[model samples]
Target chain A: MTAPRLDRGQRPDGADFPDCKRTFMEFNVLPGARAPYGIRNGAGPRRAVAGMVASTYVSGAESEGAYTLHMLTGAKGSGLPLLSHSEAHVTLYVLDGALELVLDGQRYRMGRGDSALVPAGTAYGFVMTRARTVLMAYATATALDSLLAGAPYDGFIPAEDDATGPADLLKGDFPGTTVLGALPEGTDFAEALTTLPETSVPYVLEAGMGERLLVADQLFTFVAGNRQTGDQYLSVMTQGPQGDMIPPHKHLLHDELFFCLDGAMRLKAGDELIELAPGDFCFVPRGTPHAYQFLRPFTNMIGWLQPGIFEPFFHTLGDPTELTRYPQTPAPFRFDRVIAKLDELDIVPLGRPPEAGA
Target chain B: MTAPRLDRGQRPDGADFPDCKRTFMEFNVLPGARAPYGIRNGAGPRRAVAGMVASTYVSGAESEGAYTLHMLTGAKGSGLPLLSHSEAHVTLYVLDGALELVLDGQRYRMGRGDSALVPAGTAYGFVMTRARTVLMAYATATALDSLLAGAPYDGFIPAEDDATGPADLLKGDFPGTTVLGALPEGTDFAEALTTLPETSVPYVLEAGMGERLLVADQLFTFVAGNRQTGDQYLSVMTQGPQGDMIPPHKHLLHDELFFCLDGAMRLKAGDELIELAPGDFCFVPRGTPHAYQFLRPFTNMIGWLQPGIFEPFFHTLGDPTELTRYPQTPAPFRFDRVIAKLDELDIVPLGRPPEAGA
Candidate 1:
């Protein structure tokens, strides 16, 4: 096979060259392949609302209810309607220009190269002092979509006068958002901030590779959970040694998709058994019993569960071990309590426990 | 702002958290803001074939014409119809079991922890040796959809005899794939391999922060091009000092999207001038003349060009200098030749050169 070095321009009578394969062995080392997320160009459909033009780059329909990514281009002197999301947090990053936000009866000014986290239930509105473009991310899917219902312009809308006023757009109270009137008199910025209701602020975990939770023989990293994303789906990455297996179980309200990042695994979905390797993907729909065992020395997989409310199961069942728990021995847990917790999470166990069974 | 540290559970009388403000001073050090891509769960609709089942996790409609990601599960005694793609390269990663591929008069067996690249225009067929599952990626938009037309079973297909065979499935040559007969006799594996045509193999650059291509005052990393991903788009990451600019130009065949990874940039698209800071995104549709100037020192941005055919323009126009070119001095190029090459790539230069005017 190594004897003949075919010339670059040469073509055989009947043979064809195969395309080269680029293996993502050092997954994180490569800048492009290190991330599995898709990019939605912000150049999609846009809607005009008063002085602001909003466009969605990523909708919840595509994010598995994780978040909705959108852009707001505020024309000079334009602003969004005074609004609040009852259940969703909004994070805004100013890309250009400056914004003066009146939130909770206090005024705050944010300029270019700034970001703000608006906690859920916070009443806030902003006006662009100069023509500004802002990238905004909402923790909930339908909050923004519902708020800007009929304002999307099919094509580009010039920064000219519009008939719709911000107040008129908020005539009907939205489910997650509350429309408020004017600010109260003599409101102090610092005083108002301390008076505001305590809400869970959306936080981005800047976890390094060394930061991970070890549960028994598996090492897990919680990427995004309901607490941060305000969505039901949780994204988790787990690595385990060979022979590590999870008992067959089914979920009631959540579906899961597992992406094999490294090594191999034997997965049993219902009565069907399938094998998975790196770059492989498997979807275990809701109510479909499934279990998997690592078949290689080490197996790394990313799992996403819709309605990520079940993440607490790991916290309750697993120990908070360090990240460097390789060659790990199985940690014992109370089987009865584990089984009961699974039941509470709507997970029906179908097979024997991991250590006791094959 | 620091005076009042309200209790975690305490609520103010009438105020709420306005929002937080975090500037990307150290972009990568920030946990949630480093990666710009979104994750796609591999849990979508599934269809059963004669002796196997298939499902799609990420479709092309979601990835902006980049790639279609999917999976296939083959049962015992099950096989896929012999097929070949005309315009899209198919990369398969074996997740479980084993696959026997019949290609170019040769038989290659691959098991779990293995992968293969099936080039376009090559006739190939595969069968599962045991119960197997494979994850597949197509470099084209609609090739896989066209080949698997009307053969998807809603539920599981038992591992029993079926009427559909390889020939029956390929009554007509599909748009991207062709069905073929068995390999010719007396073909030597080594001889055939040598006789195969020579093609450019896709390569990955494990470039560190220190490695980059310096073209004048700008530093670029050629992330992905036609030789690597086959088609659709080219991804490039570039960084430069403040005042670094690209002259206004428009492409006739490809749209361009810019993702601001760090720092700020002033972008002019058509008649609109928008300033983009970190976490911001902008799209310049094909035929829309645009240019950008970095507004801050050490500004970095990721650029994606649809159809990815013009990536060679950079290679042709710029000299391949060392990666460590910070505080880079400008390199001059022949304007007449550069303009001619731009015209060849369907790029209409509408503004002055980067250093000549602004």
Candidate 2:
């Protein structure tokens, strides 16, 4: 029998590039790709908390303490108990399946793509009503890390024999969090929304319910924008058809992140060209040159920009509309509009690099 | 408190498409995107088998009993005992991290991107030597499904207190499988290969050591091809730069599946457009019009085509090359050459549709 041959690449670990210190300035997360600041789907520090698998994506350290992003995945019947984060502003956005959200004792059933924001100290819990459900939780402060940092959980479903109680799982010294036991039984769930609401005390936006704007060929639905979050951050959902969407540009203020919810996105960050899949993430710090291309139909993405200074970039250029999604035939993009506001918006466009792979 | 508004889209589930019968002809899988045949990453039937979390990606039932694909992820020290599949030819390809493989009494150390094929009834086992290691196992028949179908494993790492022994975990009547206890200790590992080997009995190819070819702007590396598997299937790795890489075309002879390994891929299958992220999968059956574009720098994808009759499509159009990765500057694509082989290759070119979003 002939001996097997194994090719060793440049790196000792057979990685293409030598290990470099993680700057956290720019990062990409995809399968087999590692980033100091992000986690790929299915591979992260995970924990079985309350009945769901919580996977930490962006930790406080990775984000330089700006915010933390974690994904909560659970099957039907799995859920979180009522709890309050005294200091963290928690944003829960459902990606798939349905969720019953109990916020401040008022129940609401959230379907796919629904989102809610619970400000500091507001109690909330959720129950998965559908299987293979996914929820993304972004906290303005570290929330799940202190609870999930130990050994990784080995399974996706909690064992039937698991004897650990809520008290045991809630044993961390995280001052902001307060567990309020299980969801109340026999409570009536609030009626589903029909159109986007004018305003609510504690913000909640159902699927396709948001401030809609047509910017170029893309539709921007700001689930949580400057007015919604009190200038904390901007959380928006974008969907559009395929094309080279923008020129290379840099933000002088505010770090931004792109979390792909669906479709395909090709992004250029600094000198690196990256493609984002569903659940993939790319972080571009301020001053880093970046551009994005929607490469396929219905390329959907979620953007989280910190400090909420750039919300006007969309509002200033886009025409506010009632359409929930981009039009079948979109209006031509006005590049001149973006060019006119570049300096005022802290956007510096770079001349396109020699055509890629030329 | 003001009442909220939820935009109820055309579909009751808030999905873009109305429920349609799954024809198993074309499917796309990314985050939130569901396929009738494939499982999204982190969302599939799973089992804790031999200390690793085994996730079923493409089951035999989904593949029409032709083959099965599963992903095995483990932490350091997690592994399988020597086992043999009597009826299934198992191919193990490492996506990330390192693994110690014991094949027919010989131990081999495999790093990132390494792969080995264990033919039917060949005893093989593996131990994860690095943390967060992931291995993709593709079998010529149903192998892991019969082993991992009970329930989803609740965690990423196995529980320490679990009492289920090997015999208990291996109790299924899977005719082909035979467990051989734990890996033997004190065994020396074979040295890694520096250069590509001429040939081996049971095929093994390390990362960057496959049969390399340059077709247009993309680099095609055949880890397992027609000759390698006796015309069973062709497994290839492709990397290229950003561009509209190909015209809309249909394959008349083979069913192909694309799994995004790294970077971004925008694929058009029939009328649907899809962007594949890492771990995302898209399956296009024969006679379906399909096209693909690499939308970002270093967009990488792994493709599996069954009953491999189309290996010549690449070999005929590509020049043999020594380089392992796509070059910084690629040779321009010869579309005329592709036009020349249109009928011979069973490729029917469809004129591009109107520019997207026009």
Candidate 3:
């Protein structure tokens, strides 16, 4: 007699593997496959929080209460009072224009691709230095949710040329959020921002500096790592060639988040496929089957994995190289070598081999 | 300060993983990656054994003394006496022409892609039914190596049109090979070879008749599985789309053997890359970094993994489906799901990602 059929997610004997928990949520798609897991194109629900258009693309609920992602836009001169989150690690990546940030009695100017991390309970605030300055912020758990709890606004920030002027700062009694009286003054902006040692103390990484490593054809630059975040999360900038990669696979213990920085890619979640462009974001919770195919050469993506256990996977698989970027024509790589370490690396092949990629 | 540079094959702190054992020996490559791990093209040293040209492509030294692979060619009507291996499981896959096997007093004919398994100590023998008939045979451990001990012959076999008749059977006092008198008589040829239950009994899977499974864009047909071989090995015929697949990976405990059945694929082993055509074979021993890219659409490859511990990986990752062939356009698959199961499965991704495939 023939052996019984084994279904997907089922054992050979017909018993189902434990069903994966769906803890993360996704935002509504904004044309094509664009969603919070991809470029938002200034889309998503917005709130007027402290005089800025706070567009929350990923809420705490979407990240299993680990973090929330928001795109904050404001006109030049827009500023906020010094404030702190009693229990949140806040990280910001400047996407366009410039901003001045004050932390620990020091003032620093941040521009495109620049990033800053504010530890829990650290008093910090910022002022837009260039018109239409945009920042992508991720605050742990519900801290940003509570701080951004304000009146809903149509997703529109009055341009510098508009006469409507900035919107009023909406107020709410948000837990864990403390708004200090006013912004600190008299701290001159440093000529340049220097990255501090990885620790709970606040620090910033310049536009193109971080812990850099090359593995195969991809260059991974870490903006914030386990040591800096106390094992809460890892933020990395990845640049690689454009093509279908990784194949169908899943993670069981940690959630993964992706924010496109440049170029485009097609992502496969379960049976669903979507295309992501610059500014697009995607969140793949633990247990979700996902794969990606870059659509253009040298696709740049920002990736975050929660709880930071998989950090060793990259270090274990990568070689220390002096090269700072992916090679134009990478030498052939051996997937079988990686297959040999599946148990230690948490990478399972989803029956889909790379040959299936178009 | 930046983190320390992590070297390839080294831990983040610079410690090396346990070096993998090199147990399999490879035959000399012939005009490309065309070694015994791939198509042989009638190359390699040969022995005239039991009236057949036995070309030992993969020796016991090559498989960690686990198994050996040989290509046997003989003229039509050439036969062997009933014999049995005392401690070896023998398997045969007909590649060209036809073979008639007699086991337990039952005779059967096997054509291209047809397969048979003879359990250890089981009595069996075979005769070439078609001229220039070729059969790929594998015997556990050194059993076949001992039985095929004969005078080295210039790798040539007399054709049906040749004036010289078949070479006289070379006599050898081989251990574990008990030639039991002559071929069993009065055993009529069975109308068809029917596969027996998965057990330690002689059985045959007629061409195109085996346990077929579709996972992603590949169709895996199992001729001899773990249950049938007492967990010694698994023999599968795989058909999939042509492209880079599986990525750079490694297996720490199991050795993999590949033989091209049709079409072609490029294999990356360490720093070397080679293309394989039909009849080419590749042996990727444990801990070797390797990946494959199919050069044409719908490449067919025969794969065997020793010890059979990885069988469950396929069952776990594959869905029971009615489709008997790979889909022309397979739906997107998720490699992330597999990545999540890295600890459960033995697959470890080399630093390379799918996007790196050329």
Candidate 4:
């Protein structure tokens, strides 16, 4: 709530932010939302291939898609085609340098703050080698009709296990960010736009997957990213103090904000144990009871809700990769009749802080 | 009214025209305003004395005085560094190429849609010759204060009347972008920041001049630019079906949204003309008495109310060497007494238009 001066203090209220007279697609009035009818920048593609530069500013989008941000410069080193998808659940934030997230064939070097998961159909490849600049926020996207529920999976792939051709749905290049046997198995999404590389296309923003969450660098994307317009997309996840402990728990529906930007954040929510820093901020609303930890070393910014793309609970951590405790049951959509459907949408989560022997 | 799709469509509710991730500075962000800020590549000192390639995204910001969006790309016959400033009021738009400006010593060129005004003390310089790209918006300035009512004039020079070294502001750059021009009898103002150019310095974003009426790209800035949150920035200037005139008009409290991004737009407002097209959208608000013109070739996207930093009525132009011809008259702030103080903040306009000679 601070925005009033429009330039009166003797100068500088916006000299001008550009519009040298026409760019291209211009419209988005902002009330709640509406943007998706674009062919986007491949502007003119026939195919020449390599010059690539993928994602660059991915911060949590709204919850359903949790903390999503993308950024990838030019395309040095090499190795990038291959793709597949069932729906997202990713998380890879590395701001300002370093890359090599291979997965499926194995590579992983990631830098900055490191956090990874590439589930769905598995088949990924990223090689920047050095010229790095990253941020990738993909929380939940489970809905492929509840993720291929009946199973059988086959969005297409038989034409003799295809090999290449057809793919540029706005730019999927080798089946998007690639990985699927690297390529050769009925391929065909137009061979992911014949290998991409005309340049420009990129920029595909979407949100959903429990809504999205990732505090420290402001990846609070979609505090409620939309079950259909519940509106929520606040990103600031700077990858701060991930001192990781997360012991306390409570969430009847959802309520939180833990706004810290580096070191300091104890937040027990509800009855309060607060303890914030870096310009502080807190709330954790809903049925109240909450949980969080990281004192000796911290990095804050939380904001919750929006299906919270917990991505099937972090893909159950690559299938029980040593469950770090905390489970008295309660974690599949954590429903209690959806807490009376989120207190009729007023949302309510004010519980958990009085525990240490309340 | 259409962005719900979050992704069964994979992604497409952002970046079609996407820009407002939280922008108050950085070229500009007013379609639903959202500017996030942070851009750097470097240059400025005669654009690095003159190798050029500068990049600044936006300037004059920080809690107050904010308005700056610069982008200078060079290569072919480079140019930039013949500056001038004093009192602000500088505007230049042309996004992906075409600029030759020069000023005071004369030259002009510009491209895209074109708009030039560098008054305050004049003496500019751009010259990209070709590999160009321009989108400069200034603010918190004083130079063209609606054509200097505070008076001062005469082509500016006295920064020391030409003593050699240091005054390149950008080649033949004396007190570049000047303002007021006092002290021929000596010179002062703290030696004008020891010879300016630490990116010029000055920060503050929203301080005064609010009350909305901003629409860039066919120009029309600050009307209700937020007058501290009274809210109302309208636009819509259409015309067709053998009808569209708007010659005389008044009412500047702020509010107008002519919309119609492509055809049909027989607008007028006060005397009535109406018609609008495309996704349609009208408001007018404030005291009303609008204006518009277009018997055929339509494309409306107005939305202007007033936000400040568009040189209070473009330095009330009268001659920056001449080119003028827009709406003019009603200078410094007057349009139905600022629309009667914006009808005590209720805001209205877009009263009639259901069809019939609309």
Candidate 5:
């Protein structure tokens, strides 16, 4: 079906349509070619944390609700507060040094190349046994944005004092999170384990070529992180046409990772511009502003988001149409509506929309 | 440290050491060149089930513990027995058509591009909704050899009747398997779901370059299937030097799968000879005689085995040195001991050693 011709005056919503179509039409536009939805680079704004640093590769906004991937470095003696994600599963793969995790009065130590999985509803806290770098993946049915509420937007968490405890750093009555005052006394930690029905096993759903959603201007196939998998995390493959870009934005909660499987793209994470090719990986930590632009005809990459609560954002805004053409005009979009959703998902826009700024 | 020189009469064990060292010594052997210890190739044997055909791509012998990968094609109306593995987890990804799994008095239907994970100790059976092709992965702490004991050596299973039940096809008291005569009455099918401890989450271990083991005539890095991961099926990456070959042998149980990542090799599965290159895949089913010879400087591939029971076979018979060089002489091995272990694992030799035959 032909897309409706976008005319600003005809639509009373005052929604803005990307100028890509106009640019293509002005040239010798190829028939059946659709315009790219938007461009997003891996580089965006930067945020500094006290005694720790994190760089995100993919963000909840980009993952369309999968899992978040990030690289976190904890300084010697640094520790995160005791916290629990009531609806998220967190995984940590130590890349260097050692990490000590305190869970329900039990202590576990993980060294370099070691991994640990913390199921949802488990109260846990972690301290760096030494200076450590870790790859963290948080998978959940809820959005990380909500779970990370009250976390510092920038700068290191202030040193703990007599009046303040770890829980003071987190804000909001986030249903997904519970900051433990202290290890519960006489608590049966085993009761927190996830239980499934006897006849039920973990189910996997595969999305074929014909199954895809057009979110933000890219075509995506959900590989994991669905309701069937208990929304542990979201894994997806995305294809973006050349010139597609996403305006600068940052996620308050959630990390994102990208593996370029084919094609090329230019990523902007903070002030750094990274040009990625096939087989390259990029991590974007929470609170790091980032954007990207496809450099070739089309770029394909695998993206994951942590605490996969943000997936519904795409379903709410994206079109479930098969992507066959490029350079086609986008449907009119209300910026206010888009921004409203982003705000709820803890996504902060750092710049004007591409069309508006251009 | 230098390897001890082989003296035919010095060792009391009649196990024959490979002549690879002598052959290298006769030539201009490169100094410090070590030998490869891992064996990885997808081309192996073929097996026929009643109304179904399966070929293994990776075997536990090559995976170093993690998992076995295989491809199975089912006739339109074919079904497997109501069986369960107490120590292995099974995952099935439907590549084509539909499949109906009967588990715990419940029926789950999966279509193309669908997947299901069957936890250990769950009694289940399956029937093809139509002519179907599927990729199956069996992850376990035990080796698949014991679970598949006493099945046919060749040809399809005879149609089931009152006199011959599905349980009769299996021999030996494999602790992992329990074939239900009929769906148990008042069975709490929900109890079969996999449950993890509160502190448990899936763990991943990474094998580095220094962690490889030499077995047979190849170098392998264990990718999965180790005690750290509870000995789930083994996944390993192997590199074989040029001219390296394994004599024809057959496993009575378990399947092997291979994915050629680099170089080339010639594989003999039963009477069929197939050449493989990068990106090629081969599956060797249980009971099919197979052997392979590396054709180029070196061939690299990924191999996996189900149940992982056969991994000990390599440790028991092959050298366990860190691979430092290529085209190094293989330590001498006693075929009688090798055969003894093979017999216990349900492996049968079909031809003489490569050097003796050459």
Candidate 6:
């Protein structure tokens, strides 16, 4: 697409905050946007690092949204308070040192190779264990796009400064704007979000009637999972093991696409473990038991059911009804009735592996 | 979209290799997909270094595409025949050695910081000056997608009896199968691309009009450089020292996106002199008077417009037009009504840059 929109010409009526209480900047990550932080070339670490840095690259204000790659770094010991979001789901990527994480009555030492998903209405905190760096992102889950447009958090910040004609964003004086497109000086509010405690109860997921989840790796990666129709999830996963008997399972309602990102991977339909790799793509017919895992770790770019994201379901536990039926940690066998009920919901079993020892 | 149709269904059409004089089992840098090739996880190195050995990660037709990363070491003095790509353009990413580079009738010692783009259709060679590792990448200027799909290449060579299956790919193997979902093993062709020699040359660009490109980093972090409507080569350039004047030079009809990747830079827009860093993004409006140089060995990412893709133009430039206007070698400013002729063929600027910048 063309560059994203960058202008916020006029403030919305009644939504405008008093200029005195505000310290804000209006910048978009789109092309041709102004650099607010006044980053001078050949000056300080900015020059040593070589190139410009974004003002703010983390997504806050929305709790359960999926975050994007945060290509940014800042002063050590930088942190924020425990900010809860209402729409998007939040997943924190610990890039360097460990982090102190606290969710509803839970505590965990989250270091590199560790990730946490803060669901909507969930309380979360992040404390830089030791000069920690992470990528925290999320997208709208319920309120949909309207919520993305109407972000609820609005703290008063200034657009222009007194001593400085316009806030020198390239030089990092941007306040309020957690989304700094120019001098993306991370917001102090982001620092406020680090007050979370540790861990609480463990949450596990189970397959329900028409439920399509296959297997998920804690929060690290989702190996094999199904999605409802109209749901979407973008993940870079490696394919599965060969003929790994993935019992017939289907998305009660959803379409699916698996795009190979790296290495070579195999996709198993009914009896097919079709091979795919970078740039090669695959699709799943809704209500199909499609299972895939590579012989090796082939990066699989998976795009599952759109309009309704399915990543959350992977984190959430299954309903009690299915629990009563399966009543097991890892279901011993693929239940036929349960799968049939799932198929009725438009979630159909794509196919099943050959009988064991065959 | 449901899983793509991937059943071979007894069609068995693959195996007709077009780029036929087949070669395999060597490390390579693929066209457009050039990441460092090291030994696969746990795979031993070909030879020991400091304390580690040098094992080849990319091992296929595409693996051999990666020349620099897959520095194979079998017996002493067992360097493989120089495998250079004639179909696609290539550039070297020198990680740990010096490469003898010859370009345009000149020889240059290209080490870590030095990179030379081997234009398509050019005679390029690499001579190892040190026992070091380098990263070399190639980008096809035009007909790249076709080259990726239709080109004769083997994605991987089974590691001498290694029996893991292929990764699931998006490329539908049966060209005639429209609704057919998954692809056959031939899809591994993408990952098969790797390493090329570093017989570097000056950078070049080419692309069809209206096509936008978001060149992403290894982790898929991408930046924008494509054009939009009412766009000009000058429009994207940053405001120089004295207001945003790039001088009275005529718009050459070709624009460029100049982004500082690392280090320090010196830029001239109109009569102003400006410095640059890695994060600082700049634009060189075509047909305008603008010039820049790395005052302190800065690495920059430049996207050229009008000419479209970079590799094709460099490869096609057997006899490049020179400009007598500029006060330097390979002068940056030129008056080529020829640019206008190229523009008429639909290779024109797209949209205007924002009054602001990304």
Computed on C-alphas against the true complex, the DockQ of each candidate is 0.01, 0.02, 0.01, 0.02, 0.01, 0.02
Q: Count the backbone clashes (under 3 Å) in each candidate.
A: 22, 16, 69, 199, 96, 175
Question: Candidate 2 residues A1-358, lDDT tens each?
Answer: 1111111110122122122221223332322222323333433456776556677667776666677778776655677667887677777887655668888768886754678978777888777765345788887867656644544674333433343434444455554577777777655767544344443346566565578888666788888776656578888888765555376778888877788876566666665555565676776778777778775544678888887899878876678876655554455555567666767786776765323211
Residue ranges of candidate 4 with Cα displaced over 4 Å: A1-358, B1-79, B82-84, B89-94, B97-130, B136-251, B254-342, B346-358
Task: Write the residue-wise lDDT of candidate 2 on B60-107 in tens digits.
Answer: 755676777787866556666678876777677876546789887788
**Candidate 5, residue A109: lDDT:** 49
Identify the runs in model 2 with alpha carbons over 4 angstroms from their true place: A1-38, A147-150, A154-172, A192-200, A352-358, B1-358
Listed in order, each prediction's TM-score against the native is 0.32, 0.48, 0.44, 0.24, 0.31, 0.29
Error of 4 at B346 (Å): 8.2
Candidate 3 displacement at residue A5 in angstroms: 47
lDDT of 5 by residue, A253-318 (tens): 666666564346666665455545443465666777677766543356666666567677666555
| Candidate ordering by lDDT (highest first) | 3, 2, 1, 5, 4, 6
Q: Write the per-residue lDDT of candidate 6 for residues B1-358, one digit (tens) a residue.
A: 1111122121212232222222211112223232212122113123332111233322223222312222221111111112233444443333223434444334454333233455445444434433222322323322222212322212111121221111111232322111122111111111101122222333321101111212110001111121211121111111111112121232344444344433334454433344443323333444434444443211233332333432222222112221101111121222232233444432332233212111
Best by TM-score: 2
Evaluated against the true structure, the overall lDDT of model 3 is 0.63
lDDT of 4 by residue, A1-358 (tens): 1121211121112222121121122111111111211111111111211222332121222222333222232223332444445545343433323345555444554433333444545655454433212233333443211211122211111111222222222143222233343322321111011111222122112111122333221122221222222222222232222243343445444334444433344554443343443323443434455555544211334333334333233222122211111111212322333343443443333322222210
Q: Rank the candidates by TM-score, best first.
A: 2, 3, 1, 5, 6, 4
lDDT tens digits by residue: candidate 3, B69-134: 887866655656678888889878876556678876788866656788899988888877543467
User: Considering summed lDDT, which 10 consecutive residues are worst modelled in model 3 chain A?
Assistant: A1-10
lDDT, candidate 1, A10-117, per-residue tens: 112111112212111111111221122211123334677655666654455544554554556554556676777877666554444455666655666554323455
Worst window of 10 by summed lDDT in candidate 4 chain A? A36-45
Model 5 agreement with the true structure over B1-358: per-residue lDDT tens digits = 1221111111112123232221101111111112111121211233545345444444454444444445454444454567787666765544344456676467665443234445666667766644222334445544344443333322111121212333343443555677665423331223111222222122212112223566545665554444423444445566655553466787776666655654456666655555554434555656667676665433566666554667666655555554422324444534555655555765777656434211
DockQ of 6: 0.02
Off by over 4 Å in 5: A1-135, A138-257, A260-358, B1-69, B72-256, B259-280, B283-313, B316-358
Candidates 3 and 6: which is better by DockQ?
Answer: 6
> Residue A129 in candidate 6 has what lDDT?
33
Q: Where is the poorest 10-residue window by lDDT in model 1 chain B? A: B1-10
Q: Is the docking of candidate 3 incorrect, acceptable, medium or high quality?
A: incorrect
